[model samples]
Target: MPFPIKVCAVCSEEFELKPDKPGFANRCPECSIPESTGDSSTKQRMDADERKNASEANAARRQAMRELLYRKDS
Candidate 1:
């Protein structure tokens, strides 16, 4: 019995289902030409959102660390 797999819509790369693999991505995780697939703006927005989330999280962590160090000195 062959485990069913399909070509990625983003990069047309074939992939098989492997539950053991990390993330278990069914498609190519790195598709450089997002614009050619007719979703450049969406991809860009997604990228921006991810960057913003990461930046916000990092800022929060830094603030927490600053507070902790300040309290230790008090």
Candidate 2:
């Protein structure tokens, strides 16, 4: 029998469950599969670093804009 269709929690994509599988999955097949890196920990670390870098860049831009507006007031 075919498994019922379900929504993935991570990607919010619709997918069908595998009837041959024994357990339930919260994420879609794409999201469920980890990055094909030699080391999962390294991949996770790189992702974290990217997030941090992007966050820092955004904060810097906001600060620069605030300074520019302040200069206009002066």
Candidate 3:
């Protein structure tokens, strides 16, 4: 099947919207190229840390719920 045609949000050009296209659905491939800032690595590190902390918190919450549900009261 042919890919759907879409108008680029940035350049206002028509382009094929393919499944493997990067970035946003509304943006064309050329316009979808991510602009790199010098702090990208730092940002990635921060994001990883945030994900780790969130995972830990979620695990703690699940453990608490399990204990509460499975506890025996006499």
Q: Point to the candidate with the largest TM-score.
A: 3
Per-residue lDDT of candidate 1, residues 1-74 (tens digit): 78668567667898765555444365654543243565455554548889899999999999999998787643
Residue 63 lDDT (model 2): 97
lDDT of 2 by residue, 1-74 (tens): 78888898877899988755433476677776656546755544548889999999999999999998787643
Q: Model 2 misses residue 57 by how many Å?
A: 38
Candidate 1 regions off by >4 Å? 1-46, 72-74
RMSD of each: 9.6, 9.1, 5.7
The reply for model 3, stretches above 4 Å from the true place, is 37-74
Per-prediction TM-score to the true structure, in the order listed: 0.35, 0.42, 0.49
Higher-ranked by TM-score: 1 or 3:
3
How high is the lDDT of residue 28 in model 3?
A: 88
State candidate 2's TM-score: 0.42
